[model samples]
Target: MKLLLTSAGIMNKSIHDTLVDMLDKPIGESSALCIPTAMYGHPWVGPGVQAWEFIKGDARNPMVNLGWKSVGVLELTALPSINKDRWVSLVQETDVLLVAGGDPLYLCYWMQQSGLADLLPSLRSVYVGMSAGSMVMAPHIGEYFVGWNPPNDSDETLNLVDFAMFPHVDHEMLPHNTMAHAEKWAADIQGPAYAIDDETAIKVIDGAVEVISEGNWKLFSS
Candidate 1:
């Protein structure tokens, strides 16, 4: 699987062009699935209008609005009730997966529960993650980012990548998301980590990692 992990969605031209490059096809010709399960688990977001906005592509982050040929919902919470063959084919056939942001642990739990975590390795789809959606790809989100708790009470996530991330760094609205705070968070993480602003994205292809940014980002080496 290919990854274009963003602090926000495609918020700038560079990230947009990079996404298009990763697709190897025009955005209008591709099919996508938006996963809104993470929003439901977050207190600030919800099982309300925020989730609707993301699915409808009306959210602050530009995701589903990228003009895919077709866009559908792949709610991880709903997959467990249905048979595997039903949605697995849908996921494999899709060109990309637009995963929304909310709470990292919440998204991680559902991914594991719905078997999406297990299925991700075999799929060819490009993963486009926003905020917490991107954070969940790491081995650990660190204690600071843990909102909705999993049953085992671990801060651990999917381990899809080798590093951790701190999103929305220094945003005016989020006073606690400063670079200093991120440094403190990274101390507990004790591994490679990145603190990124909204205009930054981390791209991964064939195990090679690259920083695609129009804004600022800092990589804290392990």
Candidate 2:
């Protein structure tokens, strides 16, 4: 399976060109299963809400514009009570799986509870993860707190990829306090990790990873 773990949208022309080349298929021919599983935090709630509205509004627009025929947007917010069979079916049938940004911890918890953690690695579809989506696919979750009534515990991750990924790297949208928090989390880990700036992505193919972008990519390994 081809995986694109990006920090944010495909804002870079070079990255977009590479992504288009890697897929090797017209955008309209591919279908996507969008799992907005990571947007469980306040920082993403508003933007997620707005983006979701666009996805659902004219399915034809995003789909056609992006070179896909269908887009399945799953409502993963109601976690631990999700339908496993249905979720699995969506993941199984899609040409690509697009995971949006949010809180990594929340995304991990839901994926575990929903049994998706066990099923993703074996899937043959393209896995596209952004921000928190990228974080949950790592060995551990990055520290990005959501200011909720009571902060949720940092959950165990899917471990599909060996290293932890920090998205929105060097982006002005990322808060200063959040950066310090993430750094502490990175320091606590005993293995390699990566921090990807907005529009940059890391693609893992045949067990080898290549950084794809027009900007800088950072890595930390002990």
Candidate 3:
């Protein structure tokens, strides 16, 4: 599987180039499915549309800037109520799957219920995960306290990758995401953890992991 897990999506030219290189195909010829289900975790935060617009402005444009022919938002939660077969077909057709950030636990719940997690491993598309999206790929996600409830023992994530990921590290705008908070979170993790800022990405191809960053990031181990 090919994955580009980022703290805040593609943040620079080099990161865009890396994604393009991985695509192999000309960017204009491909399509992308941008899942924003995670943002729904806190629907009451400001206007829901504002968060959607923000994700689009910050994250979606990068894909378009790189030349993806068409990129559309597909909320995984709406799948079960609609014609899921069509959604599955869309997933199959997309060249890349971009999962946006919000709450990891919220995203995991829908992923599990929608059966998206089960199908992710077999997909040929490149997976570009932002924040919460990146975290769900780990064996376990803990020390994650957002507006929603905390993850309990029964809240198993899709263990797509081995290590847990903590995004938005030391970001001034994010009050809860400070270096001190990350240190405490990492210390409590049962396995390895990675703390990354907006301009960083953790790329995983097959089984090899590479950190690509234009900002700061660090690895924490028990």
Task: Return the TM-score for each candidate structure.
Answer: 0.98, 0.80, 0.89
List clashing residue pairs in candidate 2.
27-67, 27-68, 28-67, 38-102
Which residue runs does candidate 3 get wrong by more than 4 Å?
A: 43-47, 54-56, 59-66, 150-155
Count clashing residue pairs per candidate.
0, 4, 0
Highest lDDT model number: 1
lDDT of each: 0.94, 0.66, 0.79
Tens digits of per-residue lDDT for model 1, 136-161: 99999998988788999999999999
Candidate 2, residues 140-181, lDDT tens digits: the string is 754443332224444457777788876666666656524555
Assess candidate 2 and give its lDDT. 0.66
Model 1 scores a C-alpha lDDT of 0.94
Tally clashes: model 3. Answer: 0
